[model samples]
Target: MPLVRVDAVAADPQQLDAIGDAVHAALVDGFGIPADDRFQVLRGAAGDRVVYDPGFRGVDRDDGAVFVQVFLRRGRTDEQKRAFYRALAKHAGLAGIEPRNLVVALTENGLADWSFGNGEAQYLDDPPS
Candidate 1:
């Protein structure tokens, strides 16, 4: 499973939808994630949750970029993460922003217990047993 969260300023619904669609496409198409795999997306405005660096600022007050965090059941290699970041950046329309301005983070852990198929099947171990 992969969960994606996006944080930014009060984003347009269309933009949010587009970002979700694009992220799903990148994961499924570019990363070859199985369609049956679970993927979750959350988008929210900055509000009081985000804090900017004092020395850096943007010309457009409303022009804030998205921060994407992906959580998964297993970890990816550094190369894989870089590729995913590139793909996500393209999907999120973050091309023009400086590399340092964009942010993406990933967290991974083995699933000790997860149910599927009405609890008929459970995942409870790491890989290569």
Candidate 2:
């Protein structure tokens, strides 16, 4: 399972949901993750709590910037990551969010890092099929 965290400025619930769906689709398509495996945390910060570089890396973004972070097991190739970024940007763009205003980050960990409740590490017991 991948844990997603989205940070934005006063984001609408429906919009966030759509963006999340797009992010999940990218994960499924690029990382080969199961379509059913989804978990997310979306937060719309108040005021100027959400800060970012409007022109960092030569990308022209505005105050309506969005940051997405995904934490998952490590193993995907560089090409796979590239595919994910592209897919994620496309989805976010459809939501009226500029590609430059979107930032996607992926954090990878080992299988042993997950605990799927019931005091059990299910992932370690039965790895992804």
Candidate 3:
């Protein structure tokens, strides 16, 4: 299960909820993750916590930018990641958020690093349930 974190400028809770749902859908569709394997944190910042170059990467961004960071086990291919990004952009765009304002960051870690509960690194010895 990937630990997802979404950060964006302060906005209505409804909009933030939509963004979160869209991002989760992108993850499930692109990575083939289980539908219920969802863990996400949505942060609505007040000040300028998110800074980006309006023209960086040849894309323009505004203060409404939404930053998504996904922390997962390291096994996905580059193609899978690209598909995730595309799916995310498409979903977020449909919610009235500009595609250019979305930034996705992927971070990977080993299975030994996760502890679902009971202070146990459960997946370290076997495949995840």
In model 1, where do residues sit more than 4 Å from their true spots? Answer: 36-38, 46-49, 54-62, 94-101, 113-121, 125-129
lDDT of 1 at 39: 62
As a whole number from 0 to 100, the lDDT of residue 73 in candidate 2 is: 91
What TM-scores do the predictions have? 0.68, 0.92, 0.92
Task: Kindly list the per-residue Cα lDDT of model 1 for residues 8-127, writing each as its tens digit.
Answer: 544566766766666676577545677766466656574546665523554233345556676766756777777776777675564333334455677786665344456533565333
**By how many angstroms RMSD does model 2 differ from the true structure?**
1.5
**Candidate lDDT (C-alpha), each:** 0.60, 0.84, 0.87
Model 1 has an lDDT value of 0.60
Which residue runs does candidate 3 get wrong by more than 4 Å? none
Q: When superposed on Cα atoms, how far off is each prediction in RMSD?
A: 4.6, 1.5, 1.5
Which residue window of length 10 is worst by lDDT in model 3? 45-54
Poorest lDDT segment (10 consecutive residues) of candidate 2: 43-52
**Pairs with steric clashes in candidate 1:** none
lDDT of 3 by residue, 1-129 (tens): 899998887546788899988888899889989989989998887754766787888887888888899999999999999999999988888887888889889999988989889888889867675
Residue-level error in angstroms, candidate 3, position 112: 0.6
Residue-wise lDDT of candidate 2 within 1-129, one digit each (tens)? 899998877677777787788788888988888999999998776644876777899988886678899999988899999999998888778877777888888999988899989999888999965
Task: Rank all candidate structures by their lDDT, best first, as comma-separated numbers.
Answer: 3, 2, 1
* Candidate 3: residue pairs that collide: none
Clashes of each: 0, 0, 0
